[model samples]
Target: MEQTHSRVAVVTGGSGGIGRAVAERLGADGMNVVVAYSGNTERAAEVVKAVEAAGGRAVAGRADVAEPDEVDALFDTAEREFGGVDVVVNTAGIMILKPLVEFDLDDLDRMHRTNIRGTFVVSRAAARRLRSGGALINFSTSVTRLALPTYSAYAASKGAVDALTLVLARELRGRDITVNAVAPGPTATPLFLDGKPQEVVERMAGQAPLERLGTPDDIATAVAFLAGPARWVNGQVVYVNGGIA
Candidate 1:
């Protein structure tokens, strides 16, 4: 993905599809990784093993990224276990699809709690803790641009991430850290495929110029670039979709 070195990364939602791929990618790139999750420690442990199998160091932890204290402890674990943190990838999120008019306020709240508030918590910690030459990779979605139906609430939450990530990059000023968001489109992940009909999924995939849904590894490649050599690309949302526009 990029050049390798002695680096430490804290990847939230590491138990999930894209997060797991990103963690493994970073680990293979020669970084120690802290695979953080909100629940399902078993899946998180599996990620830790993947990282180690890639010839890098890794640990797993539980942190509800929306909570400040849990997030604080996550970064603390990174430092205590790996010496320092150079990369922070906030991938923990939840998605519930419904027309905005019929959308359950409760579902919206739950999604925002993780997608927006959770992002702020991790960004806040990364701002204070990430070592120089660090990178903060936050996840957004192409739906914000695609304006797909039933994605309004989810898009709004990720819109906040786009705004927050950009502003945080500037706030870092001389910190030598790059803050950016990765906006993946129609990715092949449990989060995206769970409730979709096969025909519907195929239609979505066909719309992309590449004629296939983006794989987790495709998005992970983008994150790896941001985490390493793409130092000049800050305060931006890098879309990893296959020409989805």
Candidate 2:
């Protein structure tokens, strides 16, 4: 829990598109990054290699952030391999699209378990034990603001994340830590393009004022900002959507 020297950052879902970008950005800032992944071990390792290639220190591990024990181990591993943890960025989440009436309870349960419960578990760990000047960055979605169709369950889960970040910021008022959420609009990631017709996807992308989909690096910039020197920012949800919503 040392915050004085170079900091350590744990980024959940660091194997994925946006998570990889954020991890790399934090590493470039002279912080050691712990790339936490749930399923993609090889991808996580590749991310670690990339970080190292950039002259940054990084390690890859597996953990289901929704589980307390796993999260504890994740932190312990990061602290043990590196020195200590000073920042946590949660980018692990899933999205299922369905009409409200047709949304299955099973899907809701799974999504909630990862998106909401995962944030609660990992964030609590950060608040309780992370060193002073640490930052906890959570993820939400712009769908919550747009109230887009077929995003009922997903939006609900992100709404919970938003609420949690705000409350935790106040709860840790004197801790010299910041709690915030990054809500990305539409990003051109593999997970986002699946199961959609090209025309439909293009139409969706065109909806944004930028006239294109966002890149993982775009959201990563916001994450790196909140996780690095944005100490004055807390309990805020920064939407990196390119004016989509």
Report the C-alpha lDDT of model 2 over 83-184, residue by residue, as the tens digit.
788999999999999999999999999999999999999999998878888999999999999998999999999999999999999999788999999999
* Tens digits of lDDT, candidate 1, 1-245: 34354899999999999999999999999999999998898999999999999888999999999989999998889989988889999999999999999999999999999999999999999999998899999999999999999999999999999999999999999999999999999999999999899999999999999999999999999999999889899999998899997
- List per-prediction Cα lDDT, in the order shown: 0.94, 0.91
Range of the 10 consecutive residues with the lowest summed lDDT in candidate 1 = 1-10
Off by over 4 Å in 1: 1-5
| Each prediction's RMSD to truth | 2.0, 1.6
lDDT assessment of candidate 1: 0.94
Instruction: State every prediction's TM-score relative to the real structure.
Output: 0.97, 0.97
- After superposition, which runs of candidate 2 have C-alpha atoms over 4 Å from their true positions? 1-3
Give candidate 2's whole-model lDDT: 0.91
Candidate 1 has a TM-score of 0.97
